[model samples]
Target: MISWIYLGIAVLFEITVAFSAGNAQGFTRLWWTIATLVSGAIATFFLSLALLDFDVGVGYAIWTSVAGVGIVVLGAVFFQERLNLRKLSGIALVIGGVIGLRLSGAA
Candidate 1:
């Protein structure tokens, strides 16, 4: 349970990293660049903590999948990015994959 919490935190930070990196404009923006780096470090740290209780492969897969989905949705909602049917389908597939991984009893 605690590990899942850590994983969730890591996912949020990873999402922050994505947005920050974009806002950094190739690292030319000082605050956004710093935010990108800091969020990435925090995300990795929490991911490592989660990995202490989870299988590495499973943990990493879940982390990336969830964070990817999160970024897509957030991009649409906050960044005015496109959210068309194709992307929606991909999101569904990724979600299904995550569920499959969780059910495999390997995490």
Candidate 2:
């Protein structure tokens, strides 16, 4: 239970780092670059903690899936990126896979 919470936090940090990286302008911006680095470090630390209890495959799949979905939605909302039908379908598939994994007792 606690490990899942850590994983969720890790995913949030991962999304934050990814979004900050996009705004960092190839790391040319100071504040955004720092945010990306700090958030990435925090995400990694929590992911490591989660790995203590979870299988690597399951943990990594869930982490990346959740973060990927979050980043995409944030990009669409905050960055004004396009979200076409194809992209929406892809997101649905990824979400479905995440649900499948969770239901498989992959913890």
Candidate 3:
């Protein structure tokens, strides 16, 4: 239970790092670049904690899926990125897969 919490936090931080990376402008922006690096390290640390109990494959899949979905939504909202039907359908598939993975007791 607690491990899942850690995993969730890890996913959030990973998304933060990824979001900031875009604004980092190829690491030219000092603040955003530093934010990216710091958040990435924090995310990795939390993931390590999660891996202590969870299966690596399962944990990693959940982490990436959650972060990927979050980043996509954030991109659409914050960056004014387009969200066409195909992209939305893809997100739905990823969400479905995540739910399936969870229900299968893969994590």
Task: Order the numbered candidates by TM-score, best leading.
Answer: 1, 2, 3
Clash pairs, candidate 2, are: none
Local distance difference test, each candidate: 0.92, 0.91, 0.90
As a whole number from 0 to 100, the lDDT of residue 3 in candidate 2 is 95
- Residue-level lDDT tens digits of model 1 in 3-106: 99999999999999988998999999999999999999999999999999999988998899889999999989987999999989989998888778678876
State the lDDT of candidate 3 residue by residue for 1-107, as single tens digits: 89999999999999999888989999999999999999999999999999998899888888887899888888899889898998898799988987887788876
What's the candidate order when arranged by decreasing lDDT? 1, 2, 3
1-107: candidate 2 lDDT, tens digit per residue? 99999999999999999889989999999999999999999999999999999999899888988899888898899879999998899899988887787788877
Worst 10 residues of 2 by lDDT: 98-107
* Best candidate (score: TM-score): 1
> What TM-score against the true fold does each predicted structure earn?
0.91, 0.89, 0.88
Query: How displaced is residue 84 in candidate 2, in Å?
Result: 1.5
Off by over 4 Å in 3: none
lDDT of 2 at 9: 97
